[model samples]
Target: MPPKQNPDAPAAPDASDALDAPPTTKTPPEVIEFWQETKQTPEELAFYAPEYLCLTILAVILFFPLGLVAAYFSYKTMQDNKQSSWEAAYVNSGRTGWLNVFAILIGLGIIYYALLFS
Candidate 1:
């Protein structure tokens, strides 16, 4: 399907359309001279942002060591709280090490069987 065009626009001009363009008016000589003579304001310089840098560095330094200490303490607490003895922990169906040992043996047996069969 063909697209529609705007009817309000005037008919297209030729290649020399720039020649028919409007003329630009110049500023007054006094205003131009004043602008030329005036010096622009200097931008503010920042020589030291040491506080911001110091804070960022301090946070990075503290976070890692603090997290490590917290993790170490948690692990030590878990290990030291010995209600989790091996026999009691692995006790299920009234068998302590039997099930665990059998499970390990079965896993090893499967690997052995695979090696033998394969």
Candidate 2:
């Protein structure tokens, strides 16, 4: 025989009820600021397109010099704008461009040594 349920008492809490509850604490100010800074408008995103394109194609096709030039312009734009959302894009583009340059140089060195020894 089953035990009788209490009619007047509150029901026991379910584990799934915890998951349905909204967060109690508010978002921190720095996190909100970071989100605002990184989120770009369409125009701002378009502004980065050419820099990104140059970084992608020029790095591979032109032996990394033109890519570095593109990176420089991107960084300069970020600096000139001062606290714009595009700053992150420019910083990433510059870093990727420089890394590509180093990779190309290292690859060339490896190929040269292989050819010389062979």
Candidate 3:
């Protein structure tokens, strides 16, 4: 016969149940704010900013895979800019995109000069 189980003892948690459980950490206030901001209504998001688009296009033309990644972030910035709280993302993306472009330009210049002098 199988051993009798103790009814008073707590049952072991099932692996599947563990997988379904939500994360223990509470969402930070800043993250909640950012999420709420990004969910702004369409009317609020109507204004279109061309900076991200321009940077995305420039990056795609000058760079390749890395440019594509920058373009994705730029696109995200555009979407996030609908609400004032999410403006930081737009600024960050724009700054990164521009920096990437400048870095590539500088690198090309250095390579050109190195080849010329050599």
Candidate 4:
């Protein structure tokens, strides 16, 4: 008689097959946004119209005299060799100094009065 095959035997599971592989990491959206923002150009400065140019010129005119007096005081102090604290004086002098102060309060009292009152 031929040997009978067993019908109740259990099948072995495959060990080489993968069923639970790890997923790849994805990049978050926030980090990708800066590259687009950095490509943008800044807006240009405005400089049209004659009035704007004139106001800029007048501002430079007003600033020049203050700078000149400060420079003159610095020059005089260097010649004297007496501590030469003109840099300190220049810092303390605010916008206008003794030049304008004396010119207004004592010397040309009428000039600033004309500017302010008249």
Off by over 4 Å in 3: 1-50, 83-88, 110-118
Please write out the lDDT profile of model 2 over residues 1-118, one tens digit for every residue: 9999889999888856543343334858775564466554334445662244444454555455644554565556555344454656566556665655664665567679889999
Q: Rate the local accuracy (lDDT) of all candidates.
A: 0.38, 0.55, 0.62, 0.37
Candidate 4 deviant stretches above 4 angstroms: 1-62, 82-118
Model 3 CA lDDT for position 99 = 59
The deviation in Å at residue 38 for candidate 2 is 14
Q: What TM-score does prediction 3 earn?
A: 0.40
lDDT of 4 by residue, 1-118 (tens): 9997788977655543212222223535553453243322121111111122232233334445544554454445333322334454334333234443432343244456678897
Clashes of each: 0, 0, 0, 0
Tens digits of per-residue lDDT, candidate 1, 1-118, equal 8988789988787745533333234757765554344321111112111122232233334344433333333333333323333233223212312333344455556678889999
Candidate 1 stretches with Cα past 4 Å from truth are: 1-94
For model 1, give the 10-residue run with minimal summed lDDT.
41-50
The per-prediction CA RMSD against the true structure, in angstroms, equals: 30.4, 12.3, 12.9, 25.3
Ranking by TM-score: 3, 2, 1, 4
lDDT of 1: 0.38
If the candidates were sorted by their lDDT against the true structure, best first, what order would they fall in? Answer: 3, 2, 1, 4
Q: In model 1, what are the clashing residue pairs, if there are any?
A: none
Candidate 3: count the clashes: 0
Best by lDDT: 3
Judging by lDDT, tell me the better candidate of 1 and 3: 3
Runs with alpha carbons beyond 4 Å of true place in candidate 2: 1-42, 49-84
